[model samples]
Target: MQQGGNPNDIFIKINALLEEAKPRFSEECCIYKVPNNIRKLNEDAYTPQVVSIGPFHHANQNLQKMEDQKRLYCRQFIERSETKNLESLVSCVQEMEEEVRSCYSDDIKLSKEEHVMLILVDSCFILEFLLRFYFLVTRGDDSILLPEQLLVHIRNDLLLVENQVPFFVLDKLYYLSFPSTLNGEDLHNHPPLLSLTCYILPGFMISEDNFVLLSVSSDVDFGRIAHFVDLTRKLLLKSSKLFQLSTSDCSREAQVTHIYSASELNELGVKFEVNKNTECLLDITLSGHTLRIPFIRVHDWTELVLRNLLAFEQCHCIHESYLTDYTLFLDFLINTDKDVDLLIKKGIIENWLGDSNAVAKMFNGLAANTVTPDFNVQYSNIFKDLNAFCAHPWNKKVATLKRDYCNTPWKTVASIAAIFLLILTIIQTIFSILQVVH
Candidate 1:
């Protein structure tokens, strides 16, 4: 205004600035598209085959087959929940449409009406599936999702990072469908969402007894769960409290360049054993010249679950690299069939994949697609301690002798007796030579 004599010019400039409106969200901020590079490795793991939940592949030809079933579930949910106002659900989402859209990294091109319907249908289907699927698996009841194989595919689909409805939206719709009630029993008890989720993805879970004894509650609001992928990750983390990053200000990694494979470590006289501790699965010990690892079951679905976790770590959870670090550690430990064999013999790895080579290939391939951080990031102390232990000559000699002479109980006994007899014979010969010389 001070420089320009005409107000029209200034108004024009302002209008130009106002034309380009800023968006509410950015990609990689919350939920994100699976990077093409990672997806290319195992496209099936990233894609939804049986059903699609979110806007990504909700309209695909293969996924469209589930739409009728989804509608059926929705109708059943409507009956079970006895929801009074369906419009309320749409209005609730419409109020925060921009915010809700922001949760997804990609632009959803659907109209407001279509978007709202997607939410209503997807959320309703998820709720019903969780409830019905849990009952079927646990109780062996009515055949809601027949052929059981379909159920398996659908279960995998639910865990896909691409197929997700926002947790907040799900939460609102959930409570709307099932209004909270205050009874004599604790309100902070088991939430159906947690139970259903636990049932769907049992492979990724560590707890053998269906996370039923989990300490989480419905009353506690888990802050801003991005979607089901994030929820699964959170559950994994909740079960393993020791995985929380240490409050150390500085990043201290170890001097380890590379961790030897399990078999290689064994040759260096490192003993292999399974850790019976019920803490973090990555809670490994290298003391007493023994390397103890927690039991990790290896199955065909193992790679799928791990790949999803790897993708999740890559796209989200950037700060805490627990899953990334764990997969990388396993990759380093299992470079070949020999390594898998050693782990199997030690009871550390339960190979349900029929052969040791498959497990080895799985780990090797997992390491291929993953982002390996600095060697000493989280396990700096453990690796440093391991390096010191492995570098010791006494440990090497002991390990060599144990491997060569004491491989089995019989071998150890025979070796001990032979050594003892040899020593006695030497002594007698020395005494005889001394008498003869005298």
Candidate 2:
């Protein structure tokens, strides 16, 4: 095996298998749940459920307000399902949402936005779980259709929702949005106990950094979310400005480009200049297509991209790992030099990338097992592709700039260490001079 080559190769093979496996599975094979609090089914083997908060509310206002008014709702969806098919999982939840809505009196006066938001919040957990499952199956695959399929799934599901709802009301709900409040904890660290649930569409984004991560499909698109999480970490590590600019610019152009589904409507990708004129272009590769969106700033596009994402937190998930891994991937890619070249040349650097230490601590909180080396192997393959892309002279220059100038605050902390040491020595000399004079 050539350094990271074995793992890379293994990941590629596994990814290929996952692609074949996904469509074969059905929603009937998956089951999910939603609850007000963390529920434990087993005492010995406990799984900390991944939960999310959005702008809408279905049940339990106290828990909702305690987090953030802007948090649409705490979405707890399917983190793990016996069925691997994300489409199947989404289908089940959509059925459940329709059932619940139909059970209510037809006379119950509910606005279209209110009804959809309610459905979205209820299904939130399921969407989360489905997305997680997709992540688990396709983690190492790097399959292009992963994100594309996810987008199509979201579009189809939304069409179903539209089919079920009164068209006039659905139209009003589509445009209705509220201002987001940034009050909340980093629940990414603290895993909650919850059941498989899915949220109705509560569309919004983290407007600042433009790291858009919303599930527009009741069926979660694991590939796109993972990519988004990775992209976000890069932005957060880079100057928040660069992250915002790159993503926003790409998003604006993306809107003008192709959008086969709502998920594609929120395509996320990395964009950089290939020439001296800094001819900016959008790489929507992560969006699951090879088409390059030209004539837009990657930065400005992220805002629109992320904004579209926020418009649909309609997907589902159950495991914190799904979201956390996505976050960790982002952090690792952004904070460390673990891109295509570094991984290809040096292979995997265990415990060097991302906030692995912090993630480890977080895992401890869940009493979870350490991530296996096998998992690392898969990620190494992703770096292989990245390395190939970066091997280009222009990409090399951009990567270098990202490494030195665009990293997060923690990476920059090393620069201050020497300054601190210099200050300490100066203070000691001053003390020595004062004592001798006295």
Pick by lDDT: which candidate is best?
A: 1
Hey, what RMSD does candidate 1 come out at?
A: 5.7
The 10-residue segment with the lowest total lDDT in model 1: 181-190
Error of 1 at 254 (Å): 5.9
- Local accuracy of candidate 2 as per-residue lDDT tens digits, 1-438: 655658888999999998876332233211112111221322211111112222112233433432331122222222232223435434443545443344322222555555545444434433333344334334443222256554333322221211122222211111121101112232242111111112212112122212222222122322222222222223232322212322432121111111121111112223321222211121112322222222222121222232222111112222111222222333333322223222223222223224434323322233122131112222233334444444557755755654674466765576467668899999999999999999
Against the true structure, candidate 1 reaches a TM-score of 0.83
In candidate 1, residue 302 scores what lDDT?
A: 76
Candidate 1 Cα errors over 4 Å, as ranges: 1-28, 137-144, 181-192, 208-210, 217-220, 245-257, 372-378, 398-425
Residue 212 lDDT in candidate 2: 28
Please state every model's RMSD to the true fold in angstroms.
5.7, 22.8
Each model's lDDT comes to: 0.71, 0.30
Q: Please, what is the TM-score per model?
A: 0.83, 0.21
Clashes of each: 1, 80
